[model samples]
Target chain A: MTTTPLSPTQRTTIGRGRNRMVEDRAELHRLLDDALIAHLGVVVGGHPVVLPVAFAVDLDGPDEDGTLYVHGSVAAGWLRGAADTTVCVTVTELDGLVAARSAFHHSMNYRSAVVIGTARIVEDPVERRHALGLTVDHMIPGRDATLREPTRKELAATAVLAVPLHEASMKARAEGPVDDAEDIEAGVWGGVIPVGRVFGAVVPDADATGPVPADVVRRARAR
Target chain B: MTTTPLSPTQRTTIGRGRNRMVEDRAELHRLLDDALIAHLGVVVGGHPVVLPVAFAVDLDGPDEDGTLYVHGSVAAGWLRGAADTTVCVTVTELDGLVAARSAFHHSMNYRSAVVIGTARIVEDPVERRHALGLTVDHMIPGRDATLREPTRKELAATAVLAVPLHEASMKARAEGPVDDAEDIEAGVWGGVIPVGRVFGAVVPDADATGPVPADVVRRARAR
Candidate 1:
């Protein structure tokens, strides 16, 4: 893990709840690795549009800090609009639901990382293939090696966009409810309800298939 | 359960995967209700910014259709930038991870709702209180009723923004992996690993007295 501190640009700086901001680069990487998807924001027709997309991060990438890769169909309008333009990608993992004595203090315990930078449409075929493999492996470790290589036609239909992780910032809340002293004295129940993603039993498709692979089983249980 | 079809304005129209768009208003409402958090996108300094926030929806509240309420501290810069301006709010639930024989066909089964409209800062005291209560109970059902009423000072420190749901659209993909016939003939494993949110046992804070409430237990199990 790199000991480099996350350099938050002016836009990426956390304005509110400064106490929640984390400057550790490793922490940002951990948050991004744990998250399954990211919300990508781009301006379309003078309006900001945000959509969820599966993403994977490359720590030793060619970008300033690293590269965050997100893919979509070439026909996707948002991807086309985001090309060579500034965008914001956010990944959040809600750890728990904090139940406070007062409604105002109710909050969610979460770790979120926001990356702001220009999105470049990757043109190099070699890098595109590498990013695709990273994306697949990031979702299911070791599963990428088992899959067949993408055909030329399949590559033609996909669009991969890379955003530099130079201006990333992470914020997290991991504590119990912070309630007023008066409310605590009032004897109201207050605590945290832990929340996490659970992977259920894998169901094979109707098509002919062999036994589920060890990698898939491990991924299911690892969660 | 309004029978009204989701009116997709010119901008709300799904451009890439039109078949995935759902026109039923009830489907949009259901997607919003099932999601605990939303990624709110707003343009700041000519760049798009996206952040996750806890949100609640009102099915019959004032607006062309209904209202989506998100609360934050009054000092939040994003809340101030979003006020009286067009913003995009997206709620996405990743249902399952679609694992295919080929990495090209690998995808995720998800339900997502996107709402784009002007955000009006809530001013009316009664409406603000109602929205605050909804935000609280939406996180943990029956939670607001158990907690004491918010003090005047607490309400003054909060900022609630409402976005109308008139321009909302929902999209969902809920099927097994769609793979090429050749991959199936290759005898490769392909299926969907179901994913969902799991809530763990509620841990009471040190200051908390008395037994955990029944509502909290029910909420934990209901998840």
Candidate 2:
């Protein structure tokens, strides 16, 4: 965790004006874990490309802080488009919309982390398996244990890339709107419209058999 | 609306399995409008740079389709780096997390649109004013009219980029877990966990303001 590769960027520097930036590693991990999806940005033929991809967090290991793993189908043009290129990956959660009296100040109060690093293709067989396990477990806890292991063919169809979570900055603005002093007296609706993701109960399909796993129930209930 | 630039490589056909892709102009505009933020993917120095940016939908004209308008401080490196270059913009809303019997089938149901096009700066005063108005109205209706207009200096400090809504695709997946017929008998808690954005009632600040505007109050309550 002391490695410069894993150190979180300082709030004062990376996240300038927004004084509410989070610099702690735990906070950054929490945001990454809670993120259901990530937008993968990569360069191809001198053009910038962004792709929405599923991701899993590897938070409990020697490499926990060293890097965050992302994987995609080998057929993915996005992955092939950016081999050995540096990328800036970002995750954002729109907490709410801050509605202020003046237009210049109105903004979305959000929690976001921007990670800058080069992506390296994972090569070691052991590491590749670990990455795949983390990827599957990210979507459904306890799934790796319950399902059949991927065959060689399946592994060939996948490609894993590791990006160090260093040079990262997390900034957020959560308070209600900061209205101008004079506009505060202008009689305008100025405050926050709290917006966030809400989870609905698990909807079991009609054809499914067997009991729900404790892990699924736990995560769903926690939400 | 039907211009296709010749590329040495073939036009990437979206996966047949993922063929609900939308190419209609109206559908693309609706998807972009619903999204408050977009991941702007641009290339800088041969690397992929993806940054989260606030954006508004600029309807091209009464007869034209529309364009996505994204603006930022003139000093923002990510924004400024993209001047006159082609960029990829993506807007996504994760509707739910789908859990299936097997890990391979687990997926998420989301609505996302990817726009790949050339970036052009909005420099003309008339178009700049129009873009600014759309930007403000996109965040909060009528607030633009109520606030002080942007002075020349403020306008000079901001840069707006418009990416035409013409060449784009909107792809959405909304089904529950797609478990194998045989695996459906494995008795797993497999279904969809719905998620979405919720807006709360507007909470006016305590600083002694005038009455809330009728339109603002009406919209807040309506939400």
Candidate 3:
């Protein structure tokens, strides 16, 4: 667990639902680990553009707080535009659907983390290679070790950006619906439908030989 | 099926992966329907801010093509900042994790749709009510029919923004990993681990009475 509290700048601070704001740094790390994809927002042509990208977090890396790595093809316009610019990276896990007695009270149970910071392109070869390994292993642990090293040409074709996790905020809602007393007394059925990601069977390619690796199988069976 | 093709503006055109660009208007509708949440990107204080929002798409609504409605508390700063401004709304479904022979080729199979346009606040009471119903039913089909109508105060406390689906783009990756011939011959495990959202059993609220509704049960059992 990190000792530092989430440093929410003027914009990162929660203004509306203050009750849902989370201050524990450990919780922020857990949410980042659990999320599979992050919605990265960057300004393009003076307009905000959001795109889904795979991400990895380096909890103990050299940064004010930590480092968040997001990669894309070097040819991606968004990646090129985001370098050295203030970007917002948001990761959300929808836990459940909150059904309330009144349509006005319907809501969703979710955990979302937002990191606002300047995204800098990783130039150091060693750090870029490490970030690439983390990105690959984030999806399936221990699988990166079995893969061949990235060729110099392949490394040149990928762009990895690192954003410091300092200016960040997390908000979560995990409870049942809060309906009005009158609506509750009306006897309308209300509950929560839990939602989660499930991994299906691992399908090997036609050219793949031998049994699926143990790490891959374990990841498939997890959760 | 809709007769219109997606109008890709200067920014909406997919520049990096042209092969993954999906042009069929019907595919766009299907992707929007399958996705549960949308990442709403709005410029706040001259920085791009993205938030996860529950969204509903109306295929025959009044607009250039159709209307995409997203709602939040009236007190939300982002919602207020987004009014009458150009906002980018993105919805993505992570279908599978593509594990390749080389770490450089690791990727994900996903379907994503991006809609960029000016967001207008829905002020018409009738249209607001209809959009509210669509938002509720978007979570669970036919759920709006069983809930109590939103009171005037509740309606006043909510802010609903509509963006025309005219400037939009859809991209998807569905196949196995594209590894190099050398990597394939090396015989490293390569395949796709399918990822999907699953709904668990419904947990009724402590005050909720009677059996779970049929629609709720059906939704829980879906996928």
TM-score of chain A of each: 0.97, 0.85, 0.97
Docking quality level of the chain pair in candidate 3: high
Count of backbone collisions in candidate 2 = 4
After aligning candidate 1 to the native by TM-score, how far in Å is the CA of A175 from where it should be? Answer: 0.8
TM per prediction = 0.98, 0.86, 0.98
lDDT (tens digit, per residue) of candidate 2 on B93-200: 887778777656667888887777778777876676667777777766666787777667767766788887555666788888877666776555577777766676
Which clashing pairs does model 1 show?
none
DockQ of each two-chain model: 0.88, 0.55, 0.89
Misplaced by over 4 Å in model 2 are: A3-21, A60-64, A140-153, B1-18, B61-64, B146-148, B206-223
Which of the two, 2 or 3, has more lDDT? Answer: 3
TM-score for candidate 1, please give it. Answer: 0.98
lDDT of 3: 0.90
Scored by lDDT, the top model is: 3
Q: Write the per-residue lDDT of candidate 3 for residues A196-218, one digit (tens) a residue.
A: 99999999998999999887898
Each model's lDDT comes to 0.88, 0.69, 0.90
B55 in model 1: Cα distance from truth in Å?
0.7
Q: DockQ ranking from best to worst?
A: 3, 1, 2
